[model samples]
Target chain A: MANSVTAAKATRGINKTIIYIVCIGLAVLSILPFWIMFVNATRSTAEIQSGLSLLPSTHLKTNWDVLTSKSFDPLKGFLNSFIISASSTALSVYFSALTAYGLVVYNWKWRQAFFTFILCVMLIPTQASAIGFYKFMYQLHLNNSFLPLILPAIAAPAMVFFMRQYLLSTLSLEIVEASRIDGSGEFATFNRIILPLMTPALATQAIFAFVASWNNLFMPLILLTDKSKYTLPIMVSLLRGDIYKTEFGSIYMGLALTALPLFVIYFLLSRYIIAGVALGGVKE
Target chain B: MRRKGTINYAKYGYIFSIPFVLVFLVFALYPTLYTAFIGFTDMKGVIPKPVHILDNPFQNFKELIFDNASFRQSLSNTFILWITNFIPQIALALLLTAWFTNQRLNIKGQGMFKVLLYMPNIITASTIAVLFSTLFAFPMGPVNSLFDALGWSDAPIQFLQQKNTARGIVSFIQFWMWYGNTMIILIAGVMGINPALFEAAAIDGASGFQTFFRVTLPSLRTIMLFTLITSMVGGLQMFDIPQLFITPAGGPDNATLTTSVFIYGQAFKGAYMYNKAAAASMIMFVIAAALAALMFYLMRDRSEGQLRKKLRAQKKAAKAAARGM
Candidate 1:
């Protein structure tokens, strides 16, 4: 009995070892694309086409020069993206939170009906609205300005839904009742008391709004005619092949420039991000 | 608790949400409605209902269905794009979720890893297009290189050049971008499961597969269905990636031209013909509404006793396994 048990235990150990190997293998597989992108940034285009560059190369400066080419103006594009994203975020958070507060704290006869209407709108994909958006902007001559890119992003249906759930979960009726009894105006109490209390939720919503606005390539692509008004993603794609994709250092720099701010903001406010996601789930 | 009074907050709340609703109405609902109204007309460039869009407004739709050669090919391409992208997305996501959820595998740093995987989603429009355009290149791209290295074939594959191939490659990039998000949601569902149920199953000597089937899956039925439904709805409206490639006056022979992209081309670039474009948008809206209804039906069980029946099945399956059936 002892001999048989020993053999079974030994086999279990071997099986676990194999599982560990496979897990790490899959993990590496998951990150391989990122690594390839980073490494390829360093090598020459010739090297990349001939074969995969498993190792990172040292042609960093050359890639940088090409990335900052006169036509692309990567920095200017980044700044433009920042300006558009910032304005959009400020608008989205304030309005979405206000809308949520208005709905939850105050009541109306058609409240349920209107709220359902918004929920239905959320199901309509961005593509479904692309034509009207383009034409509407054109009619107003807003196509040239950054407002076309920034304005629509502010009124995200998902953000309103998220804010509503947050208000429902966190805000207490008693507190609102007291504020009202103490003679604070509805909007006044919201601005003074509720907004102050809802800092964390606002911060994360701002992060999402910011990222959405920043990474929005399509609106800018279609609306902005001049090269000077482009965002980073559009700038990167418009990056001609004369520059090259293989030069590792410059491409990584571009990736970092575009993605890092988002990563930092998300990581810093990750707690709120998770909470916001969980907030939606709680409703279900 | 006393009932509260209605405060007529629509005046305030409606004002707050007006921007979104207005945008939706003006650009979305109006254009979609207008396009459908125009589909029957011969509207095109700056013309009333019957003017020309860059090409012909009704011609494309009419030709899509009735014209001899164009009808079959266009419909075939449409189905090809919808399916080639649609099917693999769900399949990969399910498999990846199952893989990641295997607790015995003991994935290290799962949270950080998941967040990293989800990075692609933040890259909404332009970035995804650039990333894929670069990745799916002919001879030089890494994907073809990998296929070659694996001895799948000797020569470089022109994935985006051929009609069917372009659809699949586009779908693959989209699949990579989407599956991570789906997995994150599924992981959330997995995390929400009552651990005690899992422990109880372990105590009964159930294998990993059995425990997953009997406990994890049944509990996740709703969330899983939600994932499936949303993916399908989202798949139908795919436009950005195709549109990005639709530039320089050429794009893969319009093989990758999605319904949304095709509609946009009709209205804006094709001829600024909103009415015919309106028709296409209406078709999409109807499809989306139908799918949503289908989703709701799938999510809700037919009756209250269905839950009891599911539990009974679990018990029966467990007993049968114990009896070595």
Candidate 2:
């Protein structure tokens, strides 16, 4: 019996070592590109052209100077991206949660129909409506403006779907009943009582919405024509495109700059992101 | 339990729903309807002409379907890239899911591994495209340098210049970016499965592989279907990586040009053919919708399947009785 137990332990030890080796090796592969990007950001164009390295070089300041010399307005790009992503995320999460709240709390006549409608819209990919959407924005004279980019978040069908699933799992109608009994107004109950309760869900969706909006290239590429209104991706694309003689170092710096905040956000809120993925799967 | 003056808040539902409803009507429904309407017209200018049904009804589609080599090429390219990326992505995801969720293994720092894997997804696709291009550029690229060190090639491969190589790199990058997300979703599906079923299988002396195939895979059908459909939709509209990879014209001979890129090219680039873009967008929508419907048909529930069987039996029985057989 003791021999068998020892043999079992030995097998488990081997299994554990194998798992660790695979996991760490894969993790290295995952982060290697980003690591190269950061290292290249600190290197000169000549050094980068020579080959890739894991080492940081002494030309970081020079790279920044090159970026500025080339008239790459990273500060403005950052601000524009921040404004668009923040407002869009806030609008998407709040309105989606509100819509989900409405559907859950009320036994209204058209509630089921409205929910089904939202689900149907969820299946219609945004690409399907791009042509008319562009034309519609043109008609409204909203091109080159942030309104078309930001305001459309109010009707994010996927966010609404996610929020609805979250609300179903966490929200209790009795709380609404209790709050109403205590003379809290409907909006007051939602604002004061419910929003706090939905913090975890809100945080997950907010991060997702923020990331999506920040990384979005398609709509902004189509809409914004003014150089000053360009978001980070647009700026990155313009810089990366050998529109002029390519400055490889400067381009890498720009990419590293764009990704830095996202990296920080991910490290801080990764748990919520993992939870959010589970929530996404709950739909099925 | 109905009480008077205790707050009839049902009316506030309308108030809450109004914002979403307005945005949907103006942005979502209107644009889709307009796209459908514009597909049948010859509105080719920056400002749309009043679309009349009788005015060159099939002109845009004729151009998109038959006359345009680039559009046809892009259609095939989108499928090729999606399938190439997705096959490896789903396979890797399944492997990771199986390992990560193995109850016996009890993998340490599972969350850290997941975050690291999913890191590529959060980065801007444009940045990634640029980064990869630079990393794998001809002659002096890191990949080529490594190949030389290993004596693997006579010369550096022009990764983004050649058609097949460009497509391959695009597919690899796409697979690298998305497999993490797919793994997370699949892990969730695995976790949602009843532990008791796994326990029962173990009690019956079934091996891990046997339990996975018999208990886990079948149970994950719905989740797999959901992932497949969403991936198909996203894959069909793939634009950013391919468009940003080299140029908006798509890499060398338009090998990496996705359908959405084609639509963007038509709408925004040289001559700005809005009518042709509308038609292409509509065609893409049909393909996406049909794929979704096919998934739904194939993945219907067993309970629903049984219900249909019973209904068919009852119908046949009723027909036989009516015929006095």
Best by lDDT: 2
TM-score of 1: 0.80
lDDT of 1 by residue, A1-284 (tens): 99998997797678667655654564565456656666766766666677676798776566667667536576787799889989989987887888788778755556667677766676676655555566667768887689877666645777888888789879998988798779897778889999989888898788777876787665676688777787887776654244544543455445545555665676676656544543343335
- What lDDT is reached at residue B212 by model 1? 71
Error of 2 at A10 (Å): 6.0
Off by over 4 Å in 1: A1-26, A46-50, A240-283, B1-43, B46-64, B68-92, B95-107, B142-155, B245-254, B268-276, B297-325
DockQ of each: 0.31, 0.62
Fnat of candidate 1: 0.28
lDDT of 1 by residue, B82-158 (tens): 66755766565555556567776465566665665565665545555655566666676787888888899788888
lDDT string, candidate 2, A38-146, tens digits: 9989999888777768899999999898887776889999999999999999999899989999988885667767877776667777888888998889989998999
The C-alpha TM-scores of every prediction are: 0.80, 0.92
- Writing each residue's lDDT as its tens digit, candidate 2 over B1-325 gives 3367455667887889999999999988899899887788767766557756635688788877998999999999999999999999999898888888877878889989999988788888888887787778677766887787788988887877889999998999999999989999899899889899999999999876788789988988889888888899999989888887876458788999999889998889887877788899999989888987776677655864685598579768978987774
TM-score of chain B alone in model 1: 0.72
Q: Give me the runs in candidate 2 sitting further than 4 Å from their true place.
A: A1-18, B1-8, B46-54, B295-325
What is model 1's DockQ versus the real complex? 0.31
TM-score of candidate 1's A chain against the true A chain: 0.83
Relative to the real complex, the DockQ score for model 2 comes to: 0.62
